[model samples]
Target: MLDLQWFFLLLVHQLIQFSSFSMGMRYLRRRTKILLMGRFLYLFLLVIMMSFSTSGQSKSAIANFQKAKEAFKQNDTDKGWVHLEKAIKKGGNTYYQPLIFAGDRRFKEGDILQAIEYYDRALQIQELSSIHLKKSIVYKYAGEFDLAIDSYQLYMKNARMSKERFRASELALENLKFTKRKYEEYMALGAPLEVVKLVFSDEKMEYFPSPTGDDRKLLFTARMVQDGAPTDENLFVAERSGAGWESRSKPVLGRVNTRLNEGASSISADGEYMVFTACNRPDGVGSCDLYYSYFDPVKGWGFPELLPGNINTKRWESQPTLGPDGTTLYFVRGSHSQADDLDIMVAYKDDEGIWSRVEKLPSEVNSSGRERSPFIHFDGTTLYFVSERSPSIGGSDFFMARRLSDSTWSEPENLGFPLNSFGDEFSLVVNAAGTHGYLSSNRGKDIVPEQDAMAEMDLYEFALPEKMKPEQRLFKDFVVVHSATRIPLGLANVKLKGLDEKEVYTGTSSKNTGLVRAMHDGSTALRVSAYKKGYLPYSAIVSKVELADNSTLYELPLTPLKSADSFVLRNLLFDTDKSELLAASEQELRLLKKLLLDNPSLNATIIGHTDNQGGRSYNQKLSEDRATAVLQWLIDSGIESGRLKAQGEGMDKPVATNDTEEGRALNRRTEVRLR
Candidate 1:
């Protein structure tokens, strides 16, 4: 009866919007944007307890709805949402205003049952297909998974929205069904994982846990806040499994933690570099940006520095996870709006140790819904992250994907129940050994319905299921050092080529420790190499047979180039017993060319040798032709012919015995002799 036409217009104006990500009470995620862990959740819980959210019909109903309009006008969504729920209860639903507003407000506020009821009430008034989409989400939250699946299917079938309009939600529905099937398939094998919550001896709120590659330290966000005080978030480190760990006394990260919030960090393999997210700082480029720090034995972590300008933009960027090599970064960037807008991005460190431009991951991995919390395992292939693109399980469920040999990703496998149940689950990290995993959970709230939401979150550890273990493989520690002095060559380049002779990994030795750790499937043939300027490069072959018993520590010696020195070019590849080179040899060939070009006065010989697999005369002619090809290449590249010569030793001078493929691989060689 009262003029309520304005309210209907307001409702019609907002037909499409939703959110994702389980709210994490821990630091960096605590107050992050819509796609990340929820900081608003802490405030939302308090509001839910204090506000009116039941249905009723009173004379003050009209006045209550008016207050909601004013709150929305002020852009105070949380305030407006609280008042709107009250307005709905006070007979405001009879006024022809969209009741879907109250449903979404309750859903995001973690009130699952009431949200469903609100949606049911909305459907009673008008049957919009979009209302089914909203019901599916609330049903999933309430663990009415069958109902959720049905609602999603109905919305997709009944909604008359055009293909251009319905494409996102349509694709999301497909992925949801597929991923949920995979989750169920894995869970059918009987529950093998036992998630054990760790009661921190210090007992502050600790989450975003990442253990060092050596398992010596645990890095996470830790905070302590009283009921009525301002919240402060800081990074904390706890010594693991020793006096520092047993005492359970955690220390604030010196120099790295500031008065403002800092959390969501990733540490390099050698513990020398840490990249994290910081927001609203004086020097920030956006509302939030990625920052980094270097760890020095004498100084702890250095004061944080802004990453490359291009990596941080005017939009939200956070949750950086460093790959095992520490050169590739998998992180998230998004607007502070819908979960559908959040996307995972990546960047690689170049030969000069600079981060290249950021690129979003392909659509095969990311969905229109929120994607965050990326964790790349030590194997360099298995990637774990959180996504709500599939709402069949938890709205934001943890998933594992593999980086294929082609550099694209395999379909995501939802880490099954026990790991991903109802409600919000995120921040799951596996140990370097792939034997165990760790995550954060509020146990009191999980087991007891009335448990206080203010309770600090505790970390949990579980034995990883065998099926969920990272690829069974081996890791090799490569220490790059000078041949003449044995001094560590920090920041040297390291590379590994697969059996197909394509590069499997290209990264640097640690900037401080000069250590480059590599991992691979035990069966693959590989070429290992390391390079530094002012030195002869190091290269070797790890045949599949040799790889079976490969040693853990490979001390690669980088010989300083000088007069009358001969070094085998072990990285060069040839087609079987043929003489012509394979494309795989280009990397070493380019390095050789660069070295010769750098030293104009140094004359060099292109020497070639072959294994004893062919006739002596035939081998001799083949070697000569191969060496001549290299010499011609050098001359054509503007090198002085007078400074170079080609020669053939054939099988006369072999580096190793000419038996077995491993020895034969070593016997066939190209060498550079400084004459």
Candidate 2:
């Protein structure tokens, strides 16, 4: 017969073995029979010992239950739980409070499976069916959808439920059914889906991963814990390396990250600017406000600045994502009174660089339920967000909407199941190429042993489903710089023009990084032009065939427009000996006209050059005719003739040796000199 001490030691050994099984050691399944035998022997010995200790009357089960409550109050959870289990075995169906209390405690502690077992034991002992509803909720969270639905239906049929409980059960049933259907559909489609946990994820909750357009850097939020209690959520960064992501992440934006919570951040496509949400800060205008910070190579991150009143209202505003244009921001705004009714709102920077009044998305995008975590793809047309609106699997599910017009959005479409499970899914961001997507989820195999399996959220990346993906377009990333110093030029105006010379798109390089990006539909040939103050303008043509390169990185060098600064006009063409410009030269002439118009106080001299083949006098006249033709075109195009002059070098000054064909071709050129 086992003594009490031996029984306790055996119980500890059994618990150790069970912990290995809980930790997902499949080989431990063979030890299950051994554990069951040990438990049986423990109960047998306890019964024998109890019989010996009691002479005529046994301890009242209610008394044992009271003792268990006292033990729990004193913080002895193990002893309390063991005593409560004994009371249930002794009292059987005579009492229900002990069983219910144990179940509630387990559920509160996040032991959903153990809570369900306790609830099931209570149901078997008595006809109290109301506990089924509690079991159903626990089952649902544990991903046991089929069992949850059955339990919910049983509770509704066998017990009197409150109106609120009835409504919740109805909603849950509908969601479960929808989730089942979606899972079936996903299986039918056979789409190739893969989800990978980021290497840097840890036991603590890590979520809201925002990667730069290059995918070389990642920023996320981690819930920091101290003394086993959550303290604050702070932004963390991980840089990609050849061996994978860095082994660990560190807090960034020193001054920007205060003791207060700072998370749900969005980095600009160029990785130069960041916008994040902070709550209850001394400078905040609302309960939660969006803040902005910019990166500088020399100074690091600037101090976080509260957004303008137009974007940050006295109400709550958070989760800001900048459009690829870097001027439009989409964020979540909640009413001061009804905090749960979050709506996705957008604001655009005006010509003065001030954000406009926040506008809630249309009803088609924002439903009566909450909508949050708006991520606009780099393509600029597709919008992905999280919503609790019906047709969702259960909780908040991922949905996408496309821009139909400037102010209109298409009906939101569900991202479909597996991508969006019964669990809440949010903070999804797609890469520039739109092929890969990242989000925070708690539905996969656990990587951190200390974390609850599939309960603590971690960042995950998956192949973007084809049905939900946006139209793939070629993107061009531009880095504009000064020619002499190689320093990035701020406020450089960049424009994309179609073959017909219609301006398709326009944006400015970042003030700090001098980077800009533009996307094309892959159908048209495009010409890109960049211009900065007091610098010569630059333009390049990308043919449709070159769009297959996926991305084209261009470093545009702009020379300062100082006195006597000259450059060859590569866009101009003429008949062999005639001075009339070709149609291809029309675009360049228009650009020059704009330049002259923009700088009215400035003047330019148009000079033409010729190769050595022609006679000196004849070549000089030919050059003169070319220069005169260009001046006339500029004048006709609205440039004041007084601001421009014409001259001919006529082989007198050659930039390249004129002996070879290539050098001769270069020598025969038109030049522009600012004076």
Candidate 3:
């Protein structure tokens, strides 16, 4: 059988060489018949030889082969390989099936060298082109670029390869060469920044580090491996202390974590909401689907629910990342059966909180090659992701795109060498400040001796170079709560209108924590408003001088609506000492009208007050006129006259002492008393 295999290989090689030469038609025809006859005779003898050799082989070798198959089926990978090795030693080398199976198992187990050895032995017995391709892929991942290129070239040279296969091999070879050049360039530049390994990392695979906007808490995925095989992947959370992360981690979202695999999570800016990937669930629409859960202060994590059908299809979907505003979700969607092609897609939540249909990013962001691990910054305009598109350093490199005003994305820019190396770099998350960044990488220098070095995927934090950093903007991260009770006011609408009177941004407070985060372009002259159904509307002008901190925490207080509750209307403005209302006060007036329309039974009195500068009788008439003017405007705008009243207090009821200009400015105000 061994001789027959060798003879067949030699005959095919000679035929390939013969076909390469120019010959007459008559000579070609005669040679083709002779080759066909030779092939037929070879197969006839090969089958007879195999039939006879089955009985001649020792019983122990066959038993070992059978045991190897059973061990592999029973999930005993190490024991299976041991038995296969013994079987190969006992005259099993004549059979290529066992050798190929062992090689495939070793490759999947991260034993690249052992897998290559087995593949080489199988190649000696038969000319299998796929084995060469598999060896090339393993070599490429192992950082053996030169050997990988050589093997790929060998695969391309085989006569039996299809044109499509040849083209793929050529492209892979070109990418490998490009990667080699990038690696050399990186070495020349030296290390760009310091990368600190977190203390939570262990011998098991730990990756996908997602830190809260403040960088005080971290969430990562860890594979639970037993006997050198992964049982499931689950999420672990750790807190930061001083400059170092806590050494220990605990499982979070216990209700969400089932026996099925769950990993690749992205937490909201306030750490209240999470969207992650879960696979093999009985209710999943695909092989993997995205799920969401919210953190409750009392009940802990709420039950996880699969995302809507618009975002998840029969095709695989995973790696969800929520945008800074908490309404946009960026995730990966691809066909699991075709593992090589993935695209970055985004879905946005409408005002009613229903997620829009998923849309794939343009070719500028998602190329024909794979693109994954999208990380939209808290700034909302800058996006960081991984892509294998052209101009990449290697396999999958980090790239970034900025959102333009027209809602289209800018051309992606490759985050240059060192930060993006020959191996895949993904799961990137940047802090709100944009000074530091975290990502998962298996660079050559990051190998730990105690772990399976070939499969070492570790979390790393590095100081972001200025060129690679996202645009730094001030993010007002605040929680809205009731002023009297201090209870969180969830689902409050937050809006930021710029000086141009354009509604620049709008978002809602988180349901779990009442947290609302908005990114500004450092233009502080804007109005920020928070409103909910049952609470009084709140609005404040953020002056230019107030945008200082990278992350400013503000406690937005909203007073609950009740009978006889009165407060100053901060936004309503009138001309100095006149009854005419300013145009800037239009927004506040409309909101008050809406409040009245929303609650038909509610009634309010519009009261006007003044400082002590004016004469008592004149001030009384002026305040009365102003109060009547406001009441008439509301009546003209369709509020029922029976539900409104107008009154004035001329320097009689001053909330602030009229001792100075600031005090006097506060005293000249409009107040609303609900009844």
Candidate 3 Cα errors over 4 Å, as ranges:
1-160, 192-197, 278-291, 296-299, 305-317, 334-341, 356-358, 388-395, 416-426, 441-456, 475-479, 485-493, 496-521, 549-553, 564-598, 603-675
What TM value does model 3 have?
0.67
Residues 1-675, candidate 1: write the lDDT tens digits: 123433433333332122333334663343345433233443454344323322235446666777887997787988887777676666544532536777776675678887778888877766778888888867765656678889998888778877787887776677556546655675677755678666462457666777777667778877775673436677877666653254464654458788787888887666677898888899998777889887767768888898873678888888888876556788889885323377888888764567876789888778867788888887778888888765445446788888885358988877766777554565778878888888765432432211233253667778888768997656666789888788878877778777675445576777667776666666678888777777787888766665565465567789887789888787776777576777888767766776777677788898988889989988888888888878887888778999999999888987777768978877778888888
lDDT of each: 0.72, 0.77, 0.76
Roughly what TM-score does model 2 have, to 2 decimal places? 0.70
Worst 10 residues of 3 by lDDT: 445-454
- Number of the top candidate by lDDT? 2
- Can you write out model 3's per-residue Cα lDDT over 1-675, one digit (the tens) per residue? 667766766776566556546456768887677667767766776676666565455356677878999999899878887888777777455666667777877766678899899899988878777888878877865768799888887877763757896676667678778776766655676655677766777666777778787789888888766887776888888888898888888788458777888889998767777888889898888889899887887776688898764887888888888876556788999997427589999997764467865688877788988888898887777889888787666567888899885258999988766677656675688887898988887663532122343266778778887766777766666678888887888878776666666444566777867886666667547667777877787777766666455355677789887777776666667878788987777766766776788778899999988999879988888778888888988999999999999999978888788999978978887787889
Q: Determine which window of 10 residues in candidate 1 has minimal summed lDDT.
A: 12-21
Q: What value does the lDDT take at residue 630 in candidate 2?
A: 99
TM-score per candidate, chains pooled: 0.67, 0.70, 0.67
Winner on lDDT between 1 and 2 is 2
Arrange candidates by TM-score, descending: 2, 3, 1
